[model samples]
Target: MREHLEGVRLGGEMEEPRIRRAAPYRRIAELREDEEWVKVMGVVVEKKDSEIVLDDGSGLLTVFSDKEGMFEEIGVGSQIRVFGRPMLSVGKEMKAEIVQKVDGLDFELYWKVMEEVKRLEEEIR
Candidate 1:
């Protein structure tokens, strides 16, 4: 039993360090953009059958995702960080093709904003 517990502890210690090291790359990707791609951090504001929209304070941008399930699970006002490439729609609207959804915020302000968005959505429904 003692040996087994030591093995479990060692496994957890090793895994925790790896997860921590990988986190910076994820956050860096959220704020860096290049000529062909843009990284953004914001809240999910709207979602439709084919697109998801995010409001990043600078502006509202639509994101197209082929995986509908991944898109559907994200709720409005949920703080998210996304990395994607920008493209122009036929009508000249800008859009992003999302590659990832980073973790959400956990502060009191974030919770309050999420609540307000949920209430507004309920009203619209």
Candidate 2:
């Protein structure tokens, strides 16, 4: 049986979607067909009727969502986190299942730490 988590929290940290940390973070340029699901954080650069583009300095990725009101809170310059599946066709793109605006996110710092973690993990092997 799972323990009740009614008021329990971690290190007094803000509540966040668990999967946001569970999913591996991938840069816009690193996303490809091999990944079944991914987590990407970037600034919104473009928005079309059913698509939104994100840029993470690595590259640009077009995210398509058919859900109504999906982009309601997302806009240009908004820092957003996305969890989705990527499809590789002529070019790379993603179909997001969850998107949310993130506050107080340090994009550069986060990426830097993640990179170091990846490097250390690879070195362990």
Candidate 3:
């Protein structure tokens, strides 16, 4: 029993949530239901104490932070990347576990490569 408990503790410590790269807000808004551990990047359009709104040109969505001080430096017009599980109420909302400030994201180049990658993957399939 003692050995079993130690193994369980070690397993719990080693199992961490997989944080994935954020998708465009357009994709998020189109989701039919809850998705696990999603991330999104956008400009901060609105902010309160624990919640913030981001618009990535595709759409605007709200991300809520559970950590009190996580949003301290976040403000309007700041670009950020946020990770959470997004769910829809009246609209799409996310309870974010991680929020990161970002700069110099080459969106144009990134999208172009994404398009090419998709095309290749489709052809292979």
Candidate 3, 1-125: lDDT as tens digits: 78767746443457678776655333444544546666677889999999998887667888887788988988898888887777776687888888999867775565577668767878999
lDDT of 3: 0.75
Candidate 2 local Cα displacement, residue 22, angstroms: 3.6
Kindly list the per-residue Cα lDDT of model 2 for residues 1-125, writing each as its tens digit: 23787677668667776553366788888887887878999999998778899888899888889898798877789889999998878676899999989866999999999899989989999
lDDT of 3 at 16: 72
By TM-score, how accurate is candidate 2?
Answer: 0.78
Kindly indicate the candidate among 2 and 3 with the higher TM-score.
2
Instruction: For model 2, state the Cα shift of residue 95 in Å.
Output: 0.3
Best by TM-score: 2
Q: Can you tell me which runs of candidate 2 are displaced by over 4 Å?
A: 1-21
What are the clash counts of all predictions, listed in order? Answer: 0, 0, 1
lDDT at residue 115 of model 3 (Cα atoms): 63
Candidate 1, residues 16-55, lDDT tens digits: the string is 4422111111122233333344455666788777677776
TM-score of candidate 1 against the unseen true structure: 0.46
